[model samples]
Target: MNREPLSTKEKLLDVAEELFASRGVEATLVGDIVQGAGQRNPSALRYHFGSRDGVLQAILEKHLTRIEERRAKLLASWPAPGPRTPRDAIELAVVPLAELLSTEAGRRYLRILGQTMYELAPDQMKGVGKYPSLSATIDLMRGCIDTLPPRVVDERIQGTLLLISAMLAIRARDMSSRRRPPLPLSTFQRNLIAMATSTLTAPHDEP
Candidate 1:
């Protein structure tokens, strides 16, 4: 079977994702994306995406929409009283993102996502209304650890995101480079979830 060639905009997006992941989003220039996409017209990226931020948002939406669908299905499949434990919530949070590790583009997306999340302030990270599955998962994970002080719980939730993103980004880089991952894929995932669960559920000392 034959597949359609990517449209000009898609070519720009594909190059942008790779460049953004490898070069860091702040460092990847619009002209670089345009040229990398094999476009002769320097204005192509601006024409298609309006600006660098537009392309960045488009890249995020492209991957996140798929992740949202996967997470929604996982949320639906949980037995009654969904996500009763930290591990359950962690799995919901991590697995959909982790599944993206299987391909080069997906791996690049993970790295880019990690960089993006790291750069955002905590307050800026709360606008997940567009990603209901992710929003629900965060709410449930916080509920599971509600015994903690409110501030601590918020920190833990933010920490969980940071940890998952960083670890997945490293794993993606390792896998992409054809280097031996510190652990096999299954072990890496299980340990990553367990570590994230601990980040959320570990007993906190009152200060």
Candidate 2:
């Protein structure tokens, strides 16, 4: 039986995803991607993607757009005036992403995203539309968010979002490797929703 070989673009994307997940964008050189994808010519990367940043953006867009589209569909079907409970808000953020874990590339994307959150400054991450789905999801939770002190609301929400990403990255890694999951996905998601809800709704003491 014969199998079709990968196109130059496809091979680059496949190798770049794994390399970016393991070594981060800045650390993983353009040449590294080319070499990993089995291309001897360095210009192949440039031919396919204009630059390193373009490649990174392509990778992010591939995953995030899917997530946002899924969120948009979910949001449209949800009750009017947006999510009513903290769990509803949390589900908006988590479920679309959780759906990605079933695929190897999706798992790699999660790891790369977790690393990007730490490796890049805020401006550097803006290429991913500043996470449109998550921003929309959080906006829908403004009711719960309003319960926190105004000063702490921004920080608390940002921190909780980071925690969710980190947790899901770990879960993605575990599932990709076929390791025993610490908890069922549903249980983990419920626990995460509980934690995010508590964090958002927790009262702040005077500083």
Candidate 3:
């Protein structure tokens, strides 16, 4: 027998996640999610999530929680940080990211995260901060970030984030016909880890 359709609320969130992931938050409107969800109620967004930003906060906070949990586990398993090789710090950030991006759902969410960071609104970022696990990772990164000189670390972090974002968004199949949709998760993860290690460990030009 055919199963009952998802509750209106569940359907809204399901559609919202895909729309937000594929289109970026600002570009994906409430109308679109509601329509895609097949819920004819005109006030569905307001009734369920309260407002546009509220919906964004709910979805992003949920997304970030899962990611940060994995990140914490990865950090916990790694060897403790030494005095000052910034590469150590970079690996701290990279490994878990590679692991997270290795899943099919993770691939989509990873790209959405990049788009979120790129198009970040201060309010939205603050909302993201309210999620416990994610807030902890950001706090930890900031604490360790002080070990390297400010200018150098700043440049490296920015560059690394961009490279990571690109890896998350651009599917492997875009370059090869033999590749399949959503990309193969493990291959993507290994390649990302390799690229991140090489970039982070490279010497600083001026120090």
Top of the candidates by lDDT: 1
Q: RMSD in angstroms, candidate 2?
A: 3.1
lDDT of each: 0.91, 0.78, 0.62
Which tens-of-lDDT digit does each residue in 1-207 have in candidate 3?
A: 999979988788878777776676789888998899997887898899998777777776665677678766766676777453444455555555555544655555665666655554333423545545545443444445555666655554555556766676665213222355454666665666567656544566653
TM-scores, all candidates, are: 0.94, 0.83, 0.67
Q: List the lowest-lDDT window of 10 residues for candidate 1.
A: 117-126
By TM-score: ranked, best first: 1, 2, 3
* RMSD, candidate 1, Å: 1.5
Model 3 earns a TM-score of 0.67
Model 2: how far residue 126 lies from native, Å: 9.3
Residue 146: error of model 2 in Å?
A: 2.3
- Sorted by lDDT, highest first, which candidate order results? 1, 2, 3
| Displacement of the residue 117 alpha carbon in candidate 1, Å | 1.1
For model 3, name the residue pairs that clash: none
The candidate that achieves the highest TM-score relative to the unseen native structure: 1
Q: List where candidate 1 sits over 4 angstroms from the true fold.
A: none
